[model samples]
Structure formats: C-alpha cells, structure tokens
Target: MLSEESSTSKENIGLTSSETSTKPRSNLMASVELTGFADNGAGTISATLGNKANKDIAKTVITQERTTDGVWTCKIDGSQAAKYKEKFNPTGCVKK
Candidate 1:
C-alpha cells in the first residue's frame, strides 16, 4: 500500500498510483568497441554508439559515407605502403 507520504517520495516522482503496479528497476551502462565487440548480446540493450567519427584521418584519398556503419576504410599512403605492407588491417595499424 502506498501512503500519501510514500507516494510523493522523490524516488517515485513523475509516476502515478496506477504506475505503482509495476515497481521501478535499475539499468546498467552498455558499451561497444571494434568488430569483435562481445559476440554475445546483452539481455537489456542500452548501447550508445557514437554517430560521429571524431577522427582526422587523411591520406592519398579519404572516402567516407554516413550510410556505411562500423566499417571505417582509409587509403594507404603510397610512400608508407612498404612499411605497412604486412600490417594488421587495410588502414595500417598504429600502436599507441
């Protein structure tokens, strides 16, 4: 039973007595990185994928499209090709 005092509690703010039928629940933060982002999905999906790529990637030719999802491609510099011939990915790997 919800007493008048309990009904107005800050925790239940913006909720109504009818809404009280369903108790409130907590949510955990979700994150993802790279193609190998957890192979298994979460029970409660709450991922925050950044829509913008805040990167300054430039080379012989820089091609990008909004429709392209998760796939980031970059042209290899002609001069640097030899140094990155056996690199990991097509864009060449840079260890920080």
Candidate 2:
C-alpha cells in the first residue's frame, strides 16, 4: 500500500514525462511565389524553404511589342528564361 502523498507525486512525474514525450515536431517544405512588380518594370517575388527561411528571388523584366493585327510578341532575357526552365524542369529543354 502506498501513501497518499507518494501516489500523488508519482502521478505528477508520470504526467510530466508523458507530456514531454508527446511534444510535437515541426515539418517544413519549400515553395515559391510571385509577389509583385518592381520600379523598373520587373516582377518582384519571394521564395521560402522553412520557418523563418525566406529570400528575395529575383525581379524579371517583361517586354511586349505589337507584331501584327490583334497579335503581340513577348520577350524575356535568355538568362532568365534558362533559369526558369531549369527550376521547373531539370531534364534539359527540347525543341521540336
């Protein structure tokens, strides 16, 4: 037979240990998004990996010109194009 005080102390210790063992852990993921535009006609955006992990990715410039009736041509920097392609699809670009 156990005393009342001893039983209470044991229950408290068990509760504390159970709470500590059941503590939740954090899981993180990587993501990217386009935020907005910049001063020099460029797109501003952000990229994040985990909690408190963020970065100002880049500002891409968008250019458009009227080519024909109801038609327009758009262009982007070659370097920027390559970077985006590589980011989305690592397996080289194919031309048909």
Candidate 3:
C-alpha cells in the first residue's frame, strides 16, 4: 500500500507540473519625444512617456533648432523640409 501511494503521488505531481504554464515578463523598449516646436510652430512641446519601467529605457530624439527671432527650424538628414512627416515633433521646418 505504501509503494502504491508513493507512485500515485509522483504521477499527480507530474500532471500538476504539465498543467502549469506561465510566461515571464520581458523588458519593453519605449521612447519619449519632446521639442520646442508644435502645430507648425504655434506651440511648445513638453511631452513625456510617463512612469516607465526605467528612465534610461525612455529616449528623446528631437530634431529642432530655435533661432534668435523666436522661430523654430527643423532639419532631417541635413536637408530642408517642405512638408515634414516623421515620428519626431515639429515635423522638420514646414517651409510652406
């Protein structure tokens, strides 16, 4: 009787292990973009990703330049933008 009980307990433990399947949480990558240009230079941008897993994981890649005349100028790949439509804010220079 003792041997049979031990064998049954081992089989039950094996069944329980196969029925459980959990996934581990992975590290996610996110970014935060901010700039001094928004809405065709009609506003200033101060955006954030807000409360991420880590501060270093959140990145900011702004591509805008402010002039002495209070004008916001943007450039992409060292070229002028006629109608910028990228992921970053300010959307290049908006030459139109």
User: Which candidate ranks first by lDDT, i.e. highest?
Assistant: 3
lDDT of 3 by residue, 1-96 (tens): 111232422222221112231111222212222332323434232222213434432332223465546786554331222332344335344322
All candidates: TM-score: 0.15, 0.22, 0.21
User: What is the Å distance of residue 96 in model 2 from its true position?
Assistant: 18
For candidate 3, the 10 contiguous residues with the lowest summed lDDT are 15-24
Pairs in clash, predicted candidate 2: none
User: Which is the winner by lDDT between candidate 1 and candidate 2?
Assistant: 2
- Pick by TM-score: 1 or 2, better one: 2
Candidate 1 per-residue lDDT over residues 1-96, each given as its tens digit: 112233322233322233343221312111221122223321111122122322222111122211124443333322322233224334442221
Name the top TM-score candidate.
2
What tens-digit string does per-residue lDDT give for candidate 2 at 2-88? Answer: 112323222222311233242212222133233222233243222222333222212223333333243444443224321333243
Query: How many clashes does each candidate structure show, in the order listed?
Result: 0, 0, 0
Task: Report the error of model 1 at residue 57, Å.
Answer: 16
- The order of the candidates by TM-score, greatest first, is 2, 3, 1
- Model 1 earns a TM-score of 0.15
* Models sorted by lDDT, best on top: 3, 2, 1
Would you list the C-alpha lDDT of every candidate in the order shown? 0.25, 0.28, 0.31
